[model samples]
Each structure stands twice: as C-alpha cells, then as structure tokens.
Target: MRNFDQWLSEMRPSINEYNFYVNFEKVYANVDSMKVELNILNSLVGSKDIEQDFREILKRYPETLRCIPTLLAVRQHEIYAQDEEGAFLYDFSRMNYSVEQYIAFMKKTGLLSLIGEHIINNLVDYCLGIETGLDSNARKNRGGHQMERLVEVYLKKAGLEYYKEMYLTQIEQTWGVDLSAISAEGTSTKRWDFVVKTDQRIYLIETNFYSSGGSKLNETSRSYKMIAEEAKSIPDTEFVWITDGGGWKSARRNLHETFDVLEHLYNIADLERGIFNSIFV
Candidate 1:
C-alpha cells in the first residue's frame, strides 16, 4: 500500500497555499478505517473478469468511492486509457466530484476544451479567458456569479426594465425628481449605489442583492451605512435603501432598522405604482 502521507508530501509543493488542502490530506491519512476501505477498492478494481457492481463495491471500499467520480470525469477526456466505447469517460467519472474538485481535475489534465465549455462557461469569462459571459464571481465576490447573471437576464426578459432604468436614468419620473442632485459635489465619499432628488428634497438610494448570508451582507450593510451617513450630511436629503436578494428572507428585519426606507421587490412595485407619493406622502 502506498503511504498516503508520502504521496501527500510529494504533492504538497504543487498545491495552492491554502490550509484546507493540508488539513484534507492529514484527515485522509490518519483515518485508519478509510485506509482499509481503500485497500479493498484497489483489490476489486484490479480484477479482470469479476463483474463489479459499483454500489456493492462501494459498500466495502467507501474511502475509494470519493475518488471514483473524479477518475470517471478524467476518463471523459481520455486522460487515462480510452474506455471500450472510445468516448471520453471523464464526465461520467466526475458525477460525484465537487465543483472545485472538478475544476482542479480539469486544470491538471490540460483539457482546455472540456474546461472551457463546462466550468469556464459558468465562471466569469474573464477568469477563464472567455470573451462574452459575465463574471460569475463579480457580484460581492459570491461564487455563484454565473447563476446571478442568469437571474439578471431572466429579470430583464420578464420586462422588469424599471429596475434597470432606475440605475441608468438618474431621473425618477413619478416623483418629478432626479437623484443625481443629492451628491452633486460627487466626492469619493458621496458615491452611492442609487440617488434621487425632488423639488422638495434630495435622497440617496442604496441597493444590494443578498444571495448568501455572510461577509457579503456585512460588507453591503457597512457600505449602505457609509452612504447613509454621507447623505445625512446634506441637511434635507433622505436615504432610501432598496435591496432584494434571496437572502433577504433571513436578513430583512435586521436591515430594515438600519436604513431609513427599506423596500423589497413587492414594495418596489407598489412604490412604482403610487410613484413618489407612497414614499414622500
């Protein structure tokens, strides 16, 4: 049996400087039960005529099961010897691998074609050298940037132009106002996510999409508070916060108290129907 620790030591220098990788190797090496299981898998796969049932094999060789999917995915690209069908088996192998593991495997295999189509297509095109797709990691650094891009496209297709127009057009037609006037000086500190100005008063608008709950929410909240404090400096200016992300279900109440006016999509529709009257009135 290959000493797992020795194998990991040989590969350690090539791995990224992340502690997680080190911890993963340590955990795998120290687990004696897992090591025994791996020996059984090695013996099973070594057989030639023994008809192997994957589930049955998995029962005895559970430790090796984790690597099977990755091996299958690599087979798709024929990184190993070509399968009987001559089709790449890598995809089949990767059925159970995590996204990161799949990506790492692709990188190791130098299968640019498969990587470009499967992983890069979903990540930010910039990171993967693609020209057209949105950066899946751009919005507040969440990993699901591709999913968010899809959502944005869907919202646009659904005739939700008001949301887009709010950012593009500084003027709020219903309220007979333009938010751009609130921070007319346009200092670094005055930059806000959204802003509107009416004949009666100026308003600063801060917008956020909270897909996941963590540092992103805290960072966004901090940004909003900064914008709010900046808006407050202007005597008559009001601060309005507009945020709608799936994570709002968990964070709505906490956020409401932090901002002067907090509105979700439901409130956005109502506010649009009533125009500025719902807010100002």
Candidate 2:
C-alpha cells in the first residue's frame, strides 16, 4: 500500500502545455471569418460628423452591422439593453432596428465616441485583440483535454488496448461483462473516460487535473470513492482514477477518504514510475 502523504506530495501544480493558454489557431480563424466585415466597419474610424457618416454607411452597407457585437467582445448576434426611456433588443445578425436606433445604441453604449475619437486605428487589429481575450475563457476546457492527452501518452507507451469515452452500456456489450453492478440495472448512465481491456480484467478509468481549489474536488473524490466500492461487485472489473494537481491539497481529507479505500487510485508520479507495467498485465 502507498502512503497517503507520499501520494499527496506528488500532486503537480499544473499540466498545461504552451498551447493550453490560448488556442491561437481558433483565435486566428475567428478573426479571419470577420475580416471583410471588420474592414468595412473601419470606415467609421475618425469621422468628424461620425453619426451622419455612420447612418449613410449603414444605409449603403447593412451587412457590416453583423460585426458590431465582436467590437464589444460579445459572441451573441442579438444583444439587449435598457435605459430610463425604454428597453431595446439589438440584432447584429440583420437590421432589426432602424438606422436611427442603431446610432442611438452606438451613442448610448459609447461606441460612437470610441470610433469617432480614433481610439483604435484599425478595426481588424482591434477585433483580433478581442478574439484573443474571448479565447482565454476556453482555457478551462483545454486544461481538461490536456490532462487526458497526457494520460494517453502513457497509455500508448504501455502498449495497452484502450478506448476513449466508453459508455457503461457499450462496455457491457463490447466485452460481454455485466455492469449492472455499477449501472444500477440500466437506470444510470455513466461514461468512463478511458476503458482498458486486458486479458484478465477490464479497467474503467477517469482522469482529471485541477490547478486551483474548489468544492468540485471534494465532490469528485467522494463520487469516485463510491465508484471504487461499486466496482468490487463486478467480477474481473476494476475502477481506476488518475488525478493530480495542487488543487487536491485543499480537499486532501476527502481525497484521503477515497484514497483509503481506492486501491487503483494513482497520479502522474505513479505513471512516471511505470504503474501501468505492474497492473495492466
């Protein structure tokens, strides 16, 4: 048996690759799709009689209005706003409001001054910056995928035949193994992150990495503890949870509770130590 403090001491601060910070490829693609519209809107920059110019431009080229939301760093085509006078819904996908009302939106939202004062020289550059900011919000999802990818590396090195994201029903049908012990007689639907099939046993695996502390860590530990217990009822089946990160430190008590009963629980350090070679066979 592994010592709990030794296992906890092996938790990593992060598993982020350089690309995990921001998906520049996605950011570039997003900005590229709006290049033409953003360029057309560029005509609004530094106009002395900006409102009149904006009205004339919209009358001639209504399609340029579709890019308005991006200027405000919003992904939605429709945006709602309200003031003391009334509430209005603005649609950037098409011209749902009159030109005067759009101008009112620009004036009220300070977008009019933003463009008319030449705060930004180029709309394309400004939109690229906005896209980058928006891309940062997706890092959490990217981080999770990064952990899965990292584990896949070890799985490949170990020469194991594993499938990604196998549902309980699929696992039962594929291997002719009865998983009703864990699936609650087909009433519960749970998906294992990675399912490894060896000559002797089937390993249902879940992987996660958290850099910061949260209640989610505690809940995950508790839930996986129950999963560990449930796996015992199914013959020749094992439950494996591979988790790491400094975030677990905050929830170490709950994690330790799970760790006390979970024999197959491992971390990145265990992977480096060739834990797969010992158990996978």
Candidate 3:
C-alpha cells in the first residue's frame, strides 16, 4: 500500500498548460464575428453632436446595437436597468424599443460618453481586449481538460488501449464485462473519464486537477471513496483515480479516507514512476 503522506507530498499546485489561461482562438472568433458592427460604431468616436450622430448610425445600421452589450463586458443580449423613473429590459438583439429609449440607455450606461469622448480609439481593439478578459472565466474548465490530456500522454506512453468519457453501460456492452456491481444493477449512470481495456481487467478511470480548495474537494473525495468501495465487488474490473493538486492538501482528511481503500489511487508523481506499466498489465 502507498503511504498517504508520501502521495500527498507529490500533489501539484497546478497543471495548467500555456493555452489554459486564455483561449485566444475563441476570443479572435468572437471579435471576428462582431468586427463589422464594431467598425461601424467607430464613427461615433469624437462626434460633434454625438446623440444626433448616434441616432443617424442606428437608422443606417440597426444591427450595431447587438454589439453594445459586449462593450460593458456583458455576454447576454438582454440587459435590465432601472432608475427613479421605471425599469426596462433593453434588448440588444433587435430594436424592440424606441430610438429615444436606447439613447437614454446609452447615456445612463455612460456608453455614449465612452464612445463620443474618444475614451477608446477603436471599438474593434477594445472588443478584442474585452473578449480576452471574458475568456479567462473558462480556465476552470480548461484545467480539467489539461489534466485529462496529461493522463492521456502517459496512457499512450504505456501503450494502453483506452476510451474516454465512456459510460458504464457502454463499457459492459463493448468489453463483455459485468459492471453491475458498481452500477447498482443498471440503475446507476456512472461515466468513467477513461476506460482502459487490458487482457486481464477493465480499468475505470477518473482524472481531475484542482488548484484551489473548497467544499467541492471534500465532496469529490467522499464520492470517490464510495466508488472505490463499490468497485471492489465487480469482477474483471479495476477502479483507478488519477488526481493531483495542492487543493487536496486542505482536504487531505477526506482524501486519506478514500486513499486508504483505493488501491490504484495515483498522482502525477506515480505516473512519472511508470505506475501504468506495472499495474495496467
């Protein structure tokens, strides 16, 4: 059995790749889709009578209104605003309101001054920067994917035949393995992150990386503990949990509970030591 303290010592702070921070391709695509409208709105920059000019622009290209929400770092088409007067839900998707109402919204939101006072030189460049900032919110999702990708690299190096995101039913059907012991006799809908098929056994794998600690870490540990217990009853099946990260440091008690019973629990350090070759066979 692997010592829990020794395994915990190998947890990584993060498994982020260079592309994990910001997906520039998605940012570029978003900006490209709105490029024409943003360029049209550029005419409002440093206008003499900005309100009249904005109204004229709206008449010519009403579609430019769709790009207005992004200026405020908002992704949705509908934005709700209220004053002492009343509340109104402004629709950026189409001209659902009068020109005067949208003008009021622009003035109240300070978008009119932002454009007319030359606060930003170009709308296209400003939107690109905005999209980049917005893309950072996707880092959590990218972090999980990065861990899976890293595990896949080692799996390939070990020459294992594996399928990703396979459901329990599919695994049983494809490999002729009986997983009902873990699947609650076909009632449980469990999906393995990677399912490796070897001559002796089917490995049901789960992979994740967490940089920060929260209740989620504890919950994950407990859930995996239950899974580890349940998996033992299934013949010709092995459960492998490949996890790492400093977040586990804070939740080590719960993690140790799972680690005590999960024989195939491993981290990045174990993978470096060729755990796959020794165990997968």
lDDT of all predictions: 0.39, 0.91, 0.91
Worst 10 residues of 3 by lDDT: 138-147
Model 3 spans with C-alpha error above 4 angstroms: none
Candidate 2 residue 181 C-alpha distance from true site, Å: 1.6
lDDT per residue, candidate 2, 1-281, as tens digits?
A: 78999889999998889987788899899989989878877888999999999999899988888888988999999999999979999999889879999999999988989999999999999988999999999988787798789999999999999999999999999999999878878888899899999999999999999899999999999999988998899999999999999999999999999999999999999999999888875
Candidate 2, lDDT over the whole model: 0.91
| RMSD (CA, Å), each prediction | 20.2, 1.6, 1.8
Model 3: residue 159 alpha-carbon error in angstroms = 2.4
TM-score of each model, paired residue for residue? 0.32, 0.94, 0.93
**Candidate 1, residue 27: lDDT:** 34
Candidate 3 lDDT, tens digit per residue, 1-281?
A: 57899889999898779888899999999999989999999988998788999999899999999999999999999999999979999999998899999999999999999989999999999999999999998887777689899999999999989999999989889988788877878998988889998889889999998888999999999988988998888887889999999999999999999998899899999999999999986
User: Among these predicted structures, which one has the highest TM-score?
Assistant: 2
> Residue 126 of candidate 2: its Cα lDDT?
92
Please give the lDDT score for candidate 3.
0.91
Q: Order the numbered candidates by lDDT, best leading.
A: 3, 2, 1
User: TM-score of predicted model 2?
Assistant: 0.94
Candidate structures ordered by TM-score, highest first: 2, 3, 1
